[model samples]
Target: MDLAQRIQKMITPTIKDQGYEIVRVQITGAKHPRLQIMAERADGTCIDVEDCATISRSISAVLDVEDPIEGEFTLEVSSPGIDRPLTRLQDYQTWAGFDVKIELKTGIDGRKRYLGRLLGLDEEQRILIECEEDEPHTLAFEDVQRAKLMLTDELIAAAATEQTK
Candidate 1:
């Protein structure tokens, strides 16, 4: 098997047993290895850093013992962060109503990039993002080059700051 596949196979279950989901495995240049593992409730809301760090250290230690690599490699374990990657249909489903950025395979509004709120996702796994400049663009999940949540702490705080605005 390939390196990433091998690592995932070895590490995923151990992580899952500890209440963490191995969202994905990323290996770049065979030297820098990062595992994007997310800890969430069964319903899938995000988890805090304490849990993430605990899981990270434990997973790293398990990997160290497994000796998946023949030589040197780095294991970085952390949350997916605010601009979380959209790697699965459920990921899109869970984050609906939140602002996100989607990169389509081809241009929809004379450009390839779109940033807006995710209205909803359908059974076909198409992403429905309501852009600022146009209607809700439905791009097939398979067609998404990259998708992630948009950073808007100010936006979030504004909503929380003034109950009546």
Candidate 2:
């Protein structure tokens, strides 16, 4: 497996034990590997720098024991930025009514990109999105490639206040 995949496997349990979700993982950089770990709360409140630092230390402890990588690298545990990726089913439930940009593998409406307010899930396990029209668009769970909760000013303000404490 790749470095990101390796890190995710190694660190997921530790992250979850701390009540955080691993949103995405990326390992980039040639000479020195860089591991970027994104985490968030169920309500979409991002894991902040302080949170990351705590998690980072825990993860670093594991890395030291496992010795996954032969050479030196940088470990960056962080929150999924403003335009954070929506990867899990719980993400849909948490950000209901928030605008999301979804890219489908196959275009259902003759287009791949969809920008709409999430309306939660339906009985059929499809996401109910309130698009431009009054009617809601139900997109299957398998369709979304990458999605992020569109951050409103209120969200930013709340996140800022959260960090202050």
Best by TM-score: 2
TM per model?
A: 0.72, 0.77
Off by over 4 Å in 1: 1-6, 29-41, 61-70, 105-110, 153-165
| Tens-digit lDDT string for candidate 1 (51-90) | 7777778777877898876676666665665566877778
Give every collision pair in model 2.
none
Model 2 scores a C-alpha lDDT of 0.81
lDDT of 2 by residue, 1-165 (tens): 777788788888988888887988887888998888888865556676788888889889999999987799988878888667788787788668667888888898697878888888888878888879557778888888778877888657755786777
For all candidates, what are the clash counts? 0, 0
Candidate 1: clashing pairs of residues: none
lDDT of 1: 0.72
lDDT of each: 0.72, 0.81
